[model samples]
Target: MGDLTMYRYDSYDQAIVDARVEEFRDQTQRRLAGQLTEDQFKPLRLMNGLYLQLHAYMLRVAIPYGTLSAAQMRVLGGIARKYDKGYGHFTTRQNLQYNWIKLSDAPDILAELAKVEMHAIQTSGNCIRNISSDQYAGVDAAEVADPRPWAELLRQWSTFHPEFTYLPRKFKIAVIAADEDRSAMRLHDIGLKLVSRDGVIGAEVYAGGGMGRTPMVAPLIRDFVTEDEIVAYLEACLRVYNRYGRRDNKYKARIKILVHEIGVEEYRRQVEEEFAHMRQQGLNPPVEELARIRAFFAPPAYETGLSDKIDRADPAFALWVDRNVAAHKAAGYAIVNISLKPQGGIPGDASAEQMELVADLADRYSLGEIRVTHAQNLVLPHVRKADLPAVWQALEEAGLAEANLDLITDIIACPGLDYCALANARAIPVAQKIAARFADPQRQRDLGELKLKISGCINACGHHHAGHIGILGVDRKGVENYQLLLGGSGAQDASLGQITGPGFSEDGVVEAIEKVTDIYLEQRQDGERFLDTYRRIGMKPFKEAIYG
Candidate 1:
């Protein structure tokens, strides 16, 4: 990954972050000594994105919209090799998590991150966290306008805001410039889609969508809103949630619960009322400021008229191109998706060496930029089509050239009991076993576009709720048990996975997954994906294959 075109830290931004680092350093010292209790220091540590995991501390650093520079990626590799383990995990939230951080080393990590005009602020706690957008924010032809500037605007305004510091629960916001929903906007607390109406640009807002023990697709809250008015409108929504969202039960604290319990119309009425009272108290940034921000995201100086010739003479390279290369707005260019899911490899774990390799590749071919996809893969967003062979060779040498982007082998699983203290069962091994069972690349290709997600616990960190074949790991009397879910998707045709029958043992779960897929293989009509078949048949055959 590389620099975010033009957005860099200013003096004010740097000063604020630098001072916060010192403040946290002192707080850490006090907690280490005997001055502060764990209860008192828990929120303090979380406010800085440091979490106590199973065996060690985990530090989650925000990579805003999953965009990074080559220099920043290099620094990240250095941090991983120098501070924690020799690797880091890119999460579904578009952030990076080092799973083996030490309490004492956390400050130094923050210091190193500050040098890159980045910080861990608002990466945690019950505040507006990182605002993610389409990885192809500015470059997508389907986009009305680049969403990165607005994402940055939200990040700046929400960072350490005093008014909404202590909400009922944590909130997430996602903005998408592309016509299609790539960032899972409907699954966030607030989702904004930039739209054009008769040459005028506005936003279509969605609220109360989320995934956990319960998953709900976000419903449209606003048909259209002026760009300038979005900030005020969002504030009104947040204010309503901050005040009235349930706090009695931790599980029921999310805005999705609030929306479900009160109904969308009632919630909309409250937000509208709130907006009427305080719609313009320095809420929206001036139009000039937005224009200034947009200038930073102007197209990079890509070599124009690059030959669209690709060396498909190599069959391996051709398969990689078909699976990993995506359509680009510009002619002679393609978006390259670097699969981190190399066969049975972890979904998003990248070694320090691999990170360095990606940095070098981005520098050489992708205009010094990389984008992290929500599906736990990396993207060389602006690679020239003619350079595909060279880039493929480089990535192949680095073990990142897996041609299974949307295949069943691309399993998304959280680092369950292997790393997290909150997990009830192991996630990584189950993912590994299932991947190994379907190891044949040709077999995976046959099962086209099947999303298999796994979660170690009911928290749904692995996004299993959105998987076409979802697996949830639970504990029954000290034994790891797995539950199967059918027909979920995170795309434009969003739907939640439904539970099928009862549970299975660890090994049994893998076999059961195979049976379900086998049924799909047998019953699927021509050109139909597993999701399509499951939807058409209503999951009865798959349920019978697993339980009957």
Candidate 2:
């Protein structure tokens, strides 16, 4: 695949990354040599996205804005095959986590990443983590504009920013240009929506939303901050949080808690004040810098006057096209969402061979660009409409074509007790059993648009709090228990899911989900989705169906 659409690292960019790899290499050597204790090396390892998981050290590699070139992806596949197991987990934050990483081999992985202009910096710890955006950033027709350029700008500004390095807690930012919130933008620490108002482009910013032990939907902090002022405004927002955010309690350290306790009105007042002061200093990047970044995301030189028609001859191909294909901004192109959630398989785990296959497919069908969706799926962002059949065929042969996009079987799940040290119960088995039960494609199509998410614990890594049918695994008096929640969403109409009565055993929870879906199937109005039906009819029916 060509590197025309991907951002290239300049000499300065290359130099800094190369330096960090060498620095981390030294740190890893010291830790291995017993010169540093576990406590001493913990923060150093975390800063580089190295985590001590349940079984091994996990290394998370950042995929900024979920965009990847074919070459970068092949390297990822290579890393999976060589360094760890022959697999890597694509995470909700648009990053890849390799679970079976070795501490001794950590620096080598970082060096491999640096070669492709990628790294794991700021993937973990109390720093601005990976900046996420809509997977269909530049291709979506409904978006106001491409948000990737702005995402890149923010990434540059926030990476190793002096003041933000030691914030009260970890901060996350998501940028979206569409009215439809595909990236769960509102659930981040800061959600920026690129908008065009009166022919002037700006951002509509939302602050302090997250899902965890306590989930809160972010409130709008500003109606509009012009593109030139967005960076300064965000800096001010962070400044307010950095100064007043809670440091006493780790539980209360997130900006969401700060925004909740101080009140949105007060937080806004402080932020506005700070923004006014910060504006004098001109913190936003130069206009030329933005233009430079934006050039990389320009639409590919598409072949014009091509037919916009797709022949859906085979029923299987037709079903896949209906579920997986989305309209692209270009006339003859389509966005192909590749589901990682195959029936009875782990949600985001992709084998090295599968990763290589996707890279190959991207090079052939797409314009050498692939996207990683927050729902734990991969996407071919710019396939021609005429090429749908061939694309589907290739995917089907490789066992990568699952016709479930947002269906009940298309679940979002975290690596639970199987790999994550903080997990209370296993998430993979529960997700697997549910997928196997609803494996029938036709049955899944019947129960349309159910966003089911699972979290091993309250960290909400799987975004369970935002699922239409959410399941949380808990430690109930030394026993693993699953609590069910209903009517949550991580969309434009965002809301937190409410818990039903008591918890259930592993198998009981699966049965409970089936019962709840049965009620939805029986009672849904014409054209209403599972979420819409739940919202309109309330939780009483679902509660009785499940609990009773």
Candidate 3:
């Protein structure tokens, strides 16, 4: 067993991140002192993951591949408490956003983050943003292999890559180990799935998938590309997109659009040609370098043959176990998902105390490691089944335990008009309203596995395009209007949701969602979920239920 924690920043890594921090520090002072104008400084701030939102500057910190150590998480909590409000929002991209950061204090924030070996570089730029992976990457019972090292490798390769720093639009990538794509693989600009071929495991590439004004599920671009060739292949794909991807229309600038316009076959042909060239140029790093990175992600010392039997003394504990705990590859260990969507609470909003508590919990229950899920939740990847009762008790006491993993109340929502300047409406309030509608624990259990996602704007940060029940906020004249969408999914069967008739007022949208759920409950066949029933009955029945 080696270190189970994520890869720490080496001196070279530290030098790179530290140099960036110092450079940005001077840039910040120059802007504050009016030595540089806002126009002159906008790109600089954005490159460091700083954005000027509605009321203040927002800092987006990258949690690479959604992995964090207890110390890192605690620092995040401290930053939230000291800098912004007492809470931070974990985003769909597995990053944390502090909405009230000041331009003057930004350098200090970055410096503190550097102490923990994390930075916000490429988090906001038109570059390959944070590479996300499955929260249960190493511990999943059916996991093929851990995807973090590969994601980290990509993070290194893509960070400050000169050719890609000025692409037409921002790029996102996700890597998943097994058949199950937990990171919403298909919705990214590029998705890499690890697959076994003739006893040789490699990546199955999916390109051109994105959700914005025009959402499309990415097509399979390559059946298999060996680990050695993956980096070169990705470079090839990005190069093709960089050369030909649309820059004239900002709306049509993503790689998905280029793939759509050029046809997947044509796009694949171009990528293969570029890949061949890149391979000859030695784009792939030597295998030894990757192996060194892999050592940091080696399996933790999992106590073997520790009893798999879960204690069933407490019914509440059992319920939590059933809902939040997932099976682990190690017999004695289990993967624990910590829900940020406590009933009627702001989705993915973790208060400083709660964050501190969770960090303490990870130290005690897990091996000082935590993961941020794409669905805006935290996960404790390694836990003894026997320790669950105590863990649940601690979580319950700290208000961190919410036994509604895939229930109706587990909503994915954006910061919306409350914090985002781009948003036309308030998504948090709407999600709160809907979560309150079905706050009863029993009611939630009855409406099993309903994924409701809300986006405040067309950017789809909340991933409304992939929800079983999607709500997109758009401006109608001057007021907030929301359109409901049905049948979208973010899993391996990734599909975009369809808009259901006209838009609704904030209250009306909540009512419409309630009506949709009511219809699902009434019409669903035995053992059918919300999406399953919707698939069976199509959209007409659902449309009638709401429209009528």
lDDT of 2 by residue, 124-161 (tens): 99999999999999989999999999999999899999
Q: What TM-score, over all chains together, does every model reach?
A: 0.98, 0.99, 0.99
lDDT of each: 0.88, 0.93, 0.91
The alpha-carbon deviation from the true structure for residue 350 of candidate 3, after best TM-score superposition, in angstroms, is 0.4
lDDT per residue as tens, model 3, 428-479: 9999999888889999999999899999999999899999999999999999
Model 2, position 173, has a per-residue lDDT of 99
Ranking by TM-score: 2, 3, 1
Error of 1 at 19 (Å): 1.3
1 or 3, greater by TM-score: 3
Please, what's the RMSD in Å of model 1? 1.4
lDDT of 1 at 375: 80
Note each model's CA RMSD in angstroms: 1.4, 0.9, 1.2
Candidate 1 residue lDDT tens string, 204-299: 999999998778999999889887887788889999999888889889999999999999999999989888876646667788877776777788
lDDT of 1: 0.88
